[model samples]
Target: MSSDFYTTSILPFAGIIIKICRAYTDSQEDFEDYYQEVCLQIWRSREQFRGDSKWSTWIYRLSLNICLTLIKKKKNNRQHVVSEYQFVEDTEENQAFEDESLNQLYDAIKQLSEIDRAVILLYLEEKPNKDIAEIIGTTPNNIAVRVNRIKERLKKILDGKIN
Candidate 1:
């Protein structure tokens, strides 16, 4: 794929990259660094695209690989803790509390095995289990099974029932 093709296809997925990076990195600096690294990886791997899947699917797989690699490398050395964010403020009563819910969700996701989190993110994006499996190099049946387990585990963690 050409650079223009990669830019047009991958740039739109930057927000997803940011969300994944935020879940993996602690501080703003590390997040930015990781984000740039992801972009670089996407550029490097663009030529490997075969058009067998949607561009978004390809980008999602690329981003997941980059995030997992960075997490494994311990490249995010910052110690800051992010409190999470809300896309909107609908009411005054529980806005702050809602952010905590987001935080809890992210925390729970971060605690999952790297492959599991990638599955969850793709699932949340409404990707088919088969697509998720393809992205993570797993079987569709396995992806479905793991996703159910991950959801239940996330619920337990958010409810403070998981130690």
Candidate 2:
């Protein structure tokens, strides 16, 4: 990929990519892998963009699709490893959110179904229902309903009312 394209196109939307990938990944390694794969796919498919929607909307769809595909692939290749102990390293991304409430909200989001997770993320990003519908391949009304339901569910989860 050309640096010019990367700088102008991808860099501006890196936060969108990061949020979508982070939603699907449990560890920083998987997050990095997802982020890289999404970026690579975006570069590879740049020519396929027809400007049918906004660039950020396209990126949202692409990032979510890539993360979901990787997740399914990992599930299909699951292995059972019995180990006595495991170690995890704290990364900057993990520490990026210093607010405890923000961390709790993210944890609650992680508990949502894949599609619901995507819906909520886009909603939180303050994307309009029409834009979210386009990215999620749903009707605007459907997205509106889903967003309301997701917000209620998220509130319940955060309030310790539901798991």
Candidate 3:
């Protein structure tokens, strides 16, 4: 991957990428692998962006898809990185959500189904339900219903009613 493209194209929108990777990964190693693969994939496929959605939206969808693929591959006993990336040390912006409450919230989010994780992440990002539905390939009503159920599920998890 060209460093210029990464510095210009991918670096500006890395927060969303990092969040998606963090949501799906459990450890620093896996997080690094997933984060690297996501950056590589985005860098590799940058030309495919045809302006259908905002750049951030494309990054989110691509990041989620890559993470899910890596997860499935890991479940099947095959773990690999598509490409090795030279990582920059995380700046304070990337480390902004290190609070205990946020960690607990992320733990609860991990307990959700993969699709639900995507839904909740996007919802939390404050994307309207309609855009979320479009990205996740579901009806807006389905997104609304699922969002409500997911909130309740999260509440239950946090309250120790469900694990």
Candidate 4:
């Protein structure tokens, strides 16, 4: 991503990107990778922003698409070799919320389908059902039903009845 674009477009919304990446990834390493890819994707897809919705909403959509695609790619390429001389520029920005409930919630979320994860994250972010539907490419009624199902699944996972 271009430095100018990164500062102007991405820095302001870095927290949202971090939160979405946290929901999808298991490690700081994966988080960093997703963050960079999402940044690059946002720069590439900036032209698609027609301003129909808020800028943050567009970033959320892009982050979800890129992270999910990366997940698919990693799943498909299990035989890849490790790179030599890997350098990790560790920073204090990789924050794990210090609440057990939040941790457990994230763990349960990981058990959801890719789209379910996105829906739940937006729901947890307290986004309205209509907005969730719009972001996830579904109807508001569909988002409502799916939210209920996701709640049930999360309850099951929380109660130790399901893995």
Candidate 5:
């Protein structure tokens, strides 16, 4: 991608890329890899964007998909390691959640299924159900129900009522 395009189109949405990548990765190395891969994919796939949805919405969907795909590939290659409840330290590159409760909530969110993780992340961003449903490829009503169920599950996870 051209520097102009990267600066104008992609850099502005780096936080969205960071958040999705951070949720899917276990360590700083993996997070950086995922972040770079998402940006690369977004740049490579720029032509595929047809303006059907807002740019941020398209970025969210693409970032989520790239993370999921990378994680799956790692798993299939037997390169994936599952660590229990390890929080990555904040770095200058990604000044991620510093609040203790936010960290705890993110830890809980990490325990969710991949789709649930994506749904909750988008929901937390305050995206409307219609927008979330469009990104997630489901009906708005399904998004509504799923959001409620995911919220309850997150609460249970955070409360230590469920693992």
Candidate 6:
């Protein structure tokens, strides 16, 4: 990638990468490591982007694929611990919840299945269902239904109702 292209296009996505890593990891160390790897992946794949989808959608898809692939590999190796991303706090501005609540929410999101967490992150980013579906390789209607279920599950988590 050209330096300017990377600076303008890829550099802007650092925070999004961090958020995705946080949603998928638990510890600060792992978060930093995964974030770096995701950046490397994005940079390596930048040339392949053809503007087919929104940049954010493409990045989200890429990050989710990386995390899930790692998860599956780990599982196969009998190392199925929750990722270090399981315990992140929400410190982003314009976030609707307080720190404690946001931490709880992140905790809840981390507990979701990989696909479910991707759906919720899309929802949190205010991406429409159609776009989310496109990013996640699912139908729009299916994404909508999944989003509803995710919301209910989130409510259960926040309300201390998960059993």
How many clashes in each candidate?
0, 0, 0, 0, 0, 7
Ranking by lDDT: 2, 3, 5, 4, 6, 1
User: Please, what are the lDDT tens digits per residue for candidate 3 over residues 1-163?
Assistant: 9889989889998888888898998777788999999999998899999999988889989999999999998999965556567464655444426685787788789999999999999999999988898789899999999999999999989987334
Best by lDDT, which number?
A: 2
Please give, for residues 1-163, the per-residue lDDT of candidate 4 as tens digits: 6799999999999988887898899777898899989988899889989999999889888898888999999899878667887554443344366665777788789899999999999988888998888889989999999999999999988999335
What is the lDDT of every predicted structure here?
Answer: 0.76, 0.90, 0.88, 0.87, 0.87, 0.80
Error of 1 at 97 (Å): 12
- Per-residue CA lDDT of model 6 for 40-128, tens digit only, reads 78889987989998898888888888877766775688755698776546445324335667777888898999889988998898889
State which candidate, 2 or 6, has the greater TM-score. Answer: 2
* lDDT (tens digit, per residue) of candidate 5 on 1-163: 7999889999999988888898898777899899989999999999999999899999999999999999889988884557887555666444346676777787788999999999999988899999999999999999999999999888887786434
Please give the lDDT score at residue 28 for candidate 5.
75
Q: Which ranges of candidate 6 are over 4 A from the true structure? A: 1-6, 77-98, 161-163
TM-score of each candidate?
0.75, 0.90, 0.84, 0.83, 0.86, 0.80
Assess candidate 5 and give its TM-score to the true structure.
0.86
Show the colliding residue pairs in model 4: none
The full ranking of all candidates by TM-score, starting with the best, is 2, 5, 3, 4, 6, 1
Q: Distance (Å) between predicted and true CA of 92, model 5? A: 13
After superposing candidate 4, which stretches have Cα over 4 Å from the reference? 2-4, 80-95, 161-163
Q: Whole-model lDDT, candidate 2?
A: 0.90
Candidates 1 and 5: which is better by TM-score?
5
Clashing pairs in 6: 25-84, 25-85, 25-86, 26-84, 26-85, 26-86, 27-84
